[model samples]
Target: MAAKKKVAVAGLASVLLVAMVVAVAVTVTKKNGGADSGAAPVSTASKAVQAICSPTDYKATCEQSLSKANTTDPKELIEVAFNATIDSIVEGIKNSTLLKQAAADDSTKQALAICEEVLGTAVDDLKRSGGKLSEIDVSKVDGYVEDLRTWLSAVITYQETCIDAFENTTGDTGEKMKKLLKNARELSSNGLAMVTDITSIISSLPMGNVGSSRKLLAEDEGRILYHKDPSEYESGTEPKFLGKVSRQLLAHVKPNAVVAQDGSGHFKTINAAIATVPKKNNVPFLIYVKAGLYKEHVEIPKGANKIVLFGDGPFKTRITGNKNFAGGVKTFQSATVAVNADDFFARDIAIENTAGPEGHQAVALRVSGDRAVFFNVNIDGFQDTLYTHTYRQFYRDCTISGTIDFIFGDALSIFQNCRFVVRKPMEHQACMLTAQGRVDPRSTGAIIIQNGDISAEPAFLAARPPIDAYLGRPWKELSRTIIMQSNIGGFINPAGWSPWMGNFALDTLYYGEYQNRGPGSNLAHRVHWKGIRQITPQIAASWAPGRAFAGDYWIRATGIPYVA
Candidate 1:
């Protein structure tokens, strides 16, 4: 009797699957002006497509991209959208290959080569997003949505990164590449919008998580917290809203490999120690560097997963390099330290680039990993410093110093109890601390600096009068950044945020401040741009680690003291 019941359930599921496939076929036939020969009404799939694409910015692109989907399931439809984006990007890569072969000089050819690489990365990101979407648990839609948003945002940034590589190259190669990618970019943006709209789409459907709603400001703007006195703390003492992991935890960490410049440990160079790390590690592979200065470009390469890199202290143990764009390396390759694997953790170390202000685009640290955490570390450089290159990242109790656009990237990152030290730039060049690259509205990538400090170096503070500084400028069209509950130094410009160009991204970007302190936090003379928002605490909380990056699930596993 029990076996018969199981067979009945299996047969029912098969029948439902056949019905869904027929519904999808009917919708596609109607869309293509073919005669509908199925009993399933076409409106079932057509209405679903309309509802999903309605929330997207490029409605036509979203609808047309999903027109050939083989299933009426919303999840399968999104997979179809991702597959369409991949097809478009593959075509873009082919065009880029042809253009690179016809380049007039080495510079143009190199730029085209960078384009091909980044575009390939973009395709990889979309493929990953599709795979994640396929494994989504309906009960945990919020967490899955955040992960999807981060990956899709990286896809948009990769496309823009390809275009930025052509800044110094000659000819219409850059323009030509842009034209080829126009459709792909639109499709990617539509993919993000569809993901953002997934909650509503699921709620409308008879789903398990229909009762669970995303905690966003639009739904609870009435719950606002009034500001307290910024003077509660002493003038020079920084406010502490979140706690840090104890130094005792560091003493307890046992190392699998040790690196020291004085030959007192397992390996003298950091790379040598990394080479010994076990491949395909399922657990943390601990590596400790004692105390000394090591000068070499270090990369925690892809597939070197779950590496724990610790040092004695930031000043006592340091890694430095001088690779810059002017030094004939690509900006993506100029990092003194690059973490390209997932679940990477670095503690109590310093990574810097000593190329000075003359180096056009030197990077101190470039992190292109998922779930990467940096604690009690110093990342210092002149320009294009700490590149939060991609993925979901967390930085706590870290100090990052740079001159212009020092902290930049498309990562969905949160900086808690961190410090942003603005250094002096070249003659007549103003300092802009952050250059966030969030190109799509639905991309969940944002720079959230809460319970932190933003001040200038002593020399930069006393620079010439015309050498001013601003919080940040938009590096992409839909860039998003928020400076909340932090101390902003008086050296910052009264306008707070700077513009990339004349009115560009001013009306499209998302810039906000909530309950910030210090002279630079004043909003009396702040920019009255459409993109800037006087956000509420509710909105600020929405960007917190627990909600924004789904930190509650993964952060604690790293033994990091996060306030999620």
Candidate 2:
């Protein structure tokens, strides 16, 4: 079965090479005012003639044209040079015996298919290459040009060898062709591997450093100073002009009530307040935190279910910490806010980890709750900022910011009408919105961004990378994420999804996009992944907050009453 598939693939590749060759011939001849005679017949002499007129023979001419054209528009010249090289190789392959053998070999169809697939990918790489080159520093352009030239030369040689092997059909010739096919496959794999490596290296190069002024407010400076204290914080026992309130106001509040830095004068640090409540008790605990800066790390253990944390205001209440994975911490252990408890609710507060660009996977908020909710909140960080670690979670009217893999986790979560601000990375600009790690195929975990605006801090960084950045990447095998009815900004990469770590993950991950608008929502250049889905409005609607995947059980846990 495998052999047959290979043969079919080979046949398809042969046809594509033939078509490309014919197209280039017609285009060149027509441009030169020559008679548009149909493709020349395939023969030994024809193959010999083509080999003699290899791309090498015209290398000088091609280079001269490219140089001249590049002076006017380097991008156009590079594209022309690239296409011409491909054209030369395709033309050479069309009349070769390899094309005939590929068409005849049923066992080698899958191998041929692999060739075609690689070719298609190469074409895309070429297109993306132009923009990629532009992003490189001027000093590195020459190096890139030289490398591309060398790669192209090797590619042309490979094509020629494949052609020559195809032409020979005798016992020895057939064996030779099979060997050539194997070599061709290896070359394709190597080429792709090189491209992936080079692209990653280039993408990670620091483009520019993020300005220090753009950093989030420090824990000490983020204290809430409201003009008038709300009645909710005032208790009968406390009565002074701008006086502290009693804990009585928290009586009606649930036992696991969560108090932020902006709450009544009760607790100092936010973590201290979170620690005051028992993890397993059903009895409600009132955690009233005074309005002040609380620079502390907080984690609610697994048994600590049904906890609530209230704050004075979303912007005023601040919980900040910073830890990064590169500092020898596992990605899971680098979170500032790690909530393992189920039925957790937080409102009117901001949770942030200030680990800068140097920190790789420092998490600001890690929620693994079965049913967790965040309302009128803000989560800030760079890479791996907000970790919806596991289970179903919901966020309503919140703000989130990050750089690479900012919003990542292995959970089914929904962000409704939230603001996503992408902070540009200083080095090679690769900012991703979300990285969902849903390893289980049966576990339908996802990150759904519904009705949001993708904004950026720096005005220049607002224009997302052409191909370097992505809306998201699948951190797990069956990972799924969707952006629906959102105002996507220009900062989004044209290829909406990026490889998680390498191409291997691309095969197993499920990434999708639906009903997104604005400059960043262009689907023309999206990655052609088999698992990437194009969802319909109905399908997207089904994933809505009150719908199947995110339903009443999840919504009610958020403490916000939902009709559905």
Candidate 3:
């Protein structure tokens, strides 16, 4: 099996290389072609950690966080770091009470009020991740980082919220407050580094001997649950995979709740309709919200599993909220729409946080549900726009717009054929499009953006000529993200990926681009980082939502269009 997979990988790589040259030539030429980014080959050296903290981006933090750990393995280091992040976030939460009381005004009080719940949620999330971590046998799984990364991604999201509470605000949220979050931030960052190390170890493991007659198309589902085929659709042929069904075909999915702001439907508000849902139904409880701006905060709780939400269209239906960092709503709680149930679905709707550019950490949508799907939806905000907070998710034919860290969170998600709109930032501020939070070697989650459009607002791009918006920066040293076979715009910075802050672990983070087109698709000048790979078709296919992210099964269940 291993030998067959290896042969398949090589065959796919060859096909991808040739296809990349012919396919992306025009786009590359538009901005100075030839994409020999001089990216180093993926390291095939022994991945056994020489020292527990060696692979981590933040060395000091890694050392301190792993101090109590008994093993030097990369997997153990990741576990320790997650625990450390939990410890630090818990400490920060404890300190938050004092800060809230010492706050000068009601705004500060409000910010701190939300922080408590946000931090409390972090504790719960980390505890869950920690528990999940203990169950992963690094030796057996090819890429077991999904659950671990999902949990750590949640921690990273929480930590960002912890600090965002101080942004653009007047009060005691000064350097001292930031200092309170330093430990948690560092631990969270280390989790990203740990994940990269684990992948490296997995890569170093030798393939076992196997027969040559095996064909990948017929692998058992149980085997697929463990090992992903190294090639997708034979590599070079990047087929335009579509949804198995169309909207008209899916119209039979009935609704149990109807919401319209004018009271012309079953309910006047989205919240009101949610109140009528019976928890844990065997079948989906679809909620249809009519076209209108509904100004309310809504949460689809865990008990509301298998709930579905659909609207007229992303442009026609708008759900808006104004909870922002300065307004004292904790970043996590500031989401205009928060989905907490498993098997949740949203289609043709717009979710927006009205908090503008200065309201750092306002989230339009925060999804914590497992097997969630958002199709033809719009997630609009500035600074932390769409948060795939946890679990396995799929976003297809959707539009997500924001300024800083727009696409963030730790869902092992697939953003397929979506439009990532890069909004302009404050004067002279640089734009970093994504901040993926994967902090464990065992984590299966990474931001996979494929066959999509990455562009900036036309006016914004015109105003900021010689553009600066970038593909992304790692929220942690081990952050993982990919832009593949997509139509990229000129807004992207030539350097591609950016560092988290102040020359952090740019080398250890896993950032990649494969067969992307457009003026911004030129990978020649991308930041020369050790872990950054100009993905071959073989590599890209292996990480497909169907194979790696496990989106193939659940996404299909959503009755949405997807490549997998």
Candidate 4:
């Protein structure tokens, strides 16, 4: 069965590549004029632009963005596209600033503020995409292309996030913001389309497997689950995957600063300790947060890279707040602990948004940094608990508890040997483990839960309310998530998944499950949506920490052991 599915997918890939190649050829010929035609030959630069942009979704935007590039190189053209996307985002920021200043109501003002912040993020991602494009190694073009697509897809997610923040705002601000960002979003999509084309052609060829060689389209097999006592999993010791280096770093390394609330450390607050760190730090700025209940909000701003934050334990040392949509704080700005820089490492810590279910869209831990790692931590909230905002992240042996859409974001992340706790919610409030927002099909943004545990809290189980809970719903058009080798409790709805809107993204989103255990893992009554399926072991492996995002590129440095 797997072989047949592989053959079908390969055939489809071949047809797609042939179509795209034909399109490029026809476009180049048309632009160069036929051999018999008496037209002047076009410049090599013009031909390059035409060929590269021909198969893109937004050809006009692609050509216009690359029109100024005089080089006859495809890579140069892509770089120009990235630059154009950056320019468009910059312009959008300007417009958002003007709108914010002119906003009358507080809601409009706050939403516009979010737009400004996310637009800056979009610019940063575009710059990173451009840098990656410049550093591509032709011999390993597959990896480079995958990286480019991931970043570009993130660029699109950032723009859409900006626009989505304007929902329910007064006036035509949302519409205006959407219009302003149309070009930027289109350019980003075009860039992703081009990058995907590279891998698509490679996969269609006979060349050895390069970057996700298989495009599995097999149906999921039904499985019977033997019910287990939830108490066993809850009481079991959490599996530790921290390597020797990580253990040493967390246990023996002296912190650069200490944050204590009892006036015993260098600083009394996390933010104060963060202020002492050098800007654009290239080396690790370690901070040991002493055992105390920190009630203040914390933010690790951009440029403060390689910050190592650890604490006594999840219950001993805690950082928490109550910012939420109900309190007029924009969801993007409501995180209790927001990590916005790269190479962020946190261990034995707990972050939470104390906002109850009534306080909707309250984010507990929001991470936007690339290559961020969280181990032995707890992210607790009611509505939106852990927000994997953007970039690449990994969480191990951590407990993330929430009510609705608890684990949500648009990042490429993996949860290995972690515990997903579903807490009791307001009446009739369904529990959603994740709401991944991968809008771009080419984007590598996904949530992969490997060897994890998903169960309800004791209070939730005691209530025994008919509160339906599912694995996830389509948060965006191309939302992608996979649960592999995990234990799902019976509290989860029999369907296994839910829908965001009335069949809005049911056909486009990608949800896969493989080799899962527990009663909830049964596939007999799972949603039969077009995008949901049971994937083969080979397909599941592609989403592993090693294969998904450049093998051990960032994970090894973080000292986190992974299933390679």
Candidate 5:
């Protein structure tokens, strides 16, 4: 009887799969059924697939892998190829376990374990992307194409990171261990090529489809996105209301509750106050914190909706910890503050990881929630400083100082007028400013900096950061970052960006520069990668902070100065 029940469930799943396939087919058919005017002729599905695969180095493999997919849409073709690549990587993961057993030394075995973890994470990331892509509609939301660009770049990175484990494998720092990683690398490369082709197609889409002339996704006024009219937003008439955190908003926007660390206020600790807030509460919940140093890891868990955390001041109100990789903690775990609530807001607070440069991979703040805003906040650390793990985030007038992969994650983020300071690295180690990791093309995350300043302390760097510090490195294979309309000083390297090492070419990373001034803004010396592009003035403005992140829709509510 139990076997029969299991059979029934399997049959139900098969039927559901068929239904989904039919629905997709109908959607595609409807899209193609549109009227087409005479202009020579349009390419067929097979021709479209062939044309799409043309940009890939492994064209035959690309064509073969995408043959079963019926859609002619470039995005669809790329998605299909990515799914195939994911399947291939899963198979590669099985082989990785075998490779681990074959490791020649303890170092190699440890590296293989890391690689195995990366493989597992990569699989999960790829699966998550399928859902993320659906949320992007270029005609409605801005930054869709850019998000795709960054996410795919990250997907490529996951494979490359796994492959990177073999780097410096000596048997102690030689090059012989790479052969074991060839299969996974090849599969990722193919996926990367397909994603790169998708970027090209999107870039060539008359600029309009990518983001131009698009309407806001929703009408969010008076900080109430649901009241009166939760209708789809229209183009040209963007509502002036942005949720700003002013004295007025604070007085009127009463926190459903308030907390303080000094016992002088409502609560003694952050977690205690968070514990008081009911789960899945829909109302705007504000947590007004007092000035004090709270040495604790805090999380405003998921569904703790519309939380607003405002502190006395960035310097006076601080949250600090010293967890690091050297302390047997993962970088993600080292985060002094982990915010997992949606529609979260924070202002005038400092979140820091006290772990010094020697500790390595220490994270000060890890935010994996949607529609988050940080105003006048200080994020300080040495490595892996700020992890915008996932979701849509906006950082305004915040100071983030770190050394290696300082700001890295898989979230769609925009940094407006924020300061990124380079902290000192140990010995001969160099500082890398931003490591924007978006591992799936369909992911809705990309790092955008508008009118910010990149600065460093002379005393902070053991070696002067001038020619050594890079603006960023492709943490993910198709890592996407745009530092435009910002003042870049000499702290950044002439190359602008760095490769991920071990044959990780800059050709796949999509780093862009637009109207950036100062000594480090010299684009003539920037790395000439196949994916990088210097945008026109018209195109550059479209990617400005307010337009790209739709800041006017939500940021004004913070009362923070938003140039967009």
Candidate 6:
């Protein structure tokens, strides 16, 4: 009776297998450009054999598809390869008793090591591949689905093989193998389910050209906290709205004002301007600076908010000061324009510290504002062109040029369609784009660059102290940055990512990229660091402040205007 019941269960499993094969065959027939011929039904035994072979053949076909698909889109090919590799690894582990056994025997130990290595590599590959896939168009869904099916079938086969192996084992080895098989099967099944969920989500997404989905993806809910209809400025339309204020209501300098060549504006000197500004208030001081090149150092202390520093234009209005990091001060401390004031806005201005490339950390603009915005501003310096110290800031259509650590900051900021030009210095200096210092895990400490152009000119000499540069270094543990949907020029190092000044940064940074296109997007030989993660869109979206970090507070502050 017991034997009959076991046989009945096995027969039921065979029936399910047959049904799955027929479903796949029907699907393939529908996809092919051929008429389906009604054929006589095969015996159950033949149907079972075909079902067993179908998954294996499907994997081979998937590999071929990836090879061909790579010709048109290497990114898609990479995704297919990654999925296939991971599935194969999970299946292989499931089938091996050595992986399941806890014995110190040579075979078991070797198998265990191999299993660990494969799993680690799979996790890393998945992260990187997932990030790349987020940037692809929805049209790739069919290919992804087909690839997933192949992987799923492989996993199922592996589980069956492992069960059979366990049944044939003996003594302690058999018991250990059985336990291992159970765990392996559970893990593989969970992983397969996760892939299925991801595919389902992709399928449900509205299908259209890339342009149609751009708005849906870019509309970050957290942006609502900082959203505002731009002010109507002389430069056509703005992204945020500006309110009218009395010209006479001077928190520091009067509105529609001018500063002359001798540093004698309404407030006389830079110190005078800083001193006159009232302390600890949300009311902004409107300093309408005229078009002139003023050679002086400036600092806006803490408690100053809503300060509007306006100039004629970046070319016409310049604040030039000379300072270097080697001169006793730290890199972040040496700045020409250091603003600790919250809610700071600067437009149509150029802040440059002409201390030369010799200055290891001469900063142009050091901002530590809660809500800061720079528009049409040109920040010029050799090292640390723009130091976003803390809080949230946005740079819109600005030109930031520097040689080393050009854009180093610890702020949660976004650069929208901005220009990042790498200036080659007389000495060989390794130019790094960012060094994000995110102190707290809860803090939103990520630099997002959306649609930007990077250009560079050759330097005069080679191999200076800081000339051999990396694009960026992680200033602190858990520092994050994303260069999404952008073009990287050849001037960028072939290695792409840079290590910190010392080995300390290696263990703490979380650097990654998504949908970066152009000649420099290749990551075949990127640095192998555990901290650097290639994340998914879902993970990236969670990092958004309004969505995850400071949702309520941000929404209350910005009350962002809804723009169609």
- The numbered model that scores best in TM-score is 4
Candidate closest to the true structure, highest lDDT: 4
Each model's number of backbone clashes?
0, 36, 14, 1, 23, 18
- Pairs in steric clash, model 1: none
In model 1, the worst 10-residue window by lDDT is 218-227
List residue ranges in candidate 5 displaced over 4 A. 1-217, 225-245, 248-251, 439-444, 461-467, 529-532, 550-552
Candidate 6, residue 167: how far the Cα is off, in Å: 64
lDDT of the candidates, in the order given: 0.79, 0.56, 0.70, 0.80, 0.68, 0.56
What TM-score does candidate 5 get on C-alpha atoms? 0.65
Ranking by TM-score: 4, 1, 3, 5, 2, 6
State, as a TM-score between 0 and 1, how close model 6 is to the true structure: 0.51
What is the TM-score of candidate 4? 0.86
TM-score of each: 0.83, 0.53, 0.66, 0.86, 0.65, 0.51
Which tens-of-lDDT digit does each residue in 1-564 have in candidate 6?
535533443344344455655765565555563354554544433333333323332333343324333222223333554565555555555544344455555434443443443344344435444563434334444434433432332343333323332232234554554464454344344334434534444556555563333333334422332333334233332212132221212112235334555555675454555566788755545576667777788887766666677777799888988776556444545688988666677777899988887777688888755567777789998877888765567776789888877886656677767888777765444677877765333334577776667666555223344244455777666677877667777556777778765677677778877767777666776677877788688765654433322212322232222111
Q: Candidate 5, residues 135-241: lDDT per residue as tens digits? A: 44434323444444444544555565565555545563224334544544554566556544444343454424433333333334434732223243233332112
Residue 487 shift from truth in candidate 2, angstroms: 0.9
**Alpha-carbon RMSD, candidate 4:** 9.8
What is the Cα root-mean-square deviation between model 3 and the actual structure? 13.7
lDDT of 6: 0.56
lDDT of 4: 0.80
Tens-digit per-residue lDDT, 197-235, candidate 3: 554444454534211111221233323322234342144
Candidate 2 weakest ten by summed lDDT: 218-227
Expressed as tens digits, the lDDT of each residue in 237-293 for candidate 2 is 332211122132232222233343445444556666666667474533445344455
- lDDT score of model 3? 0.70
lDDT at position 166, candidate 1: 84
Q: Which has the higher TM-score value, candidate number 2 or candidate number 5?
A: 5
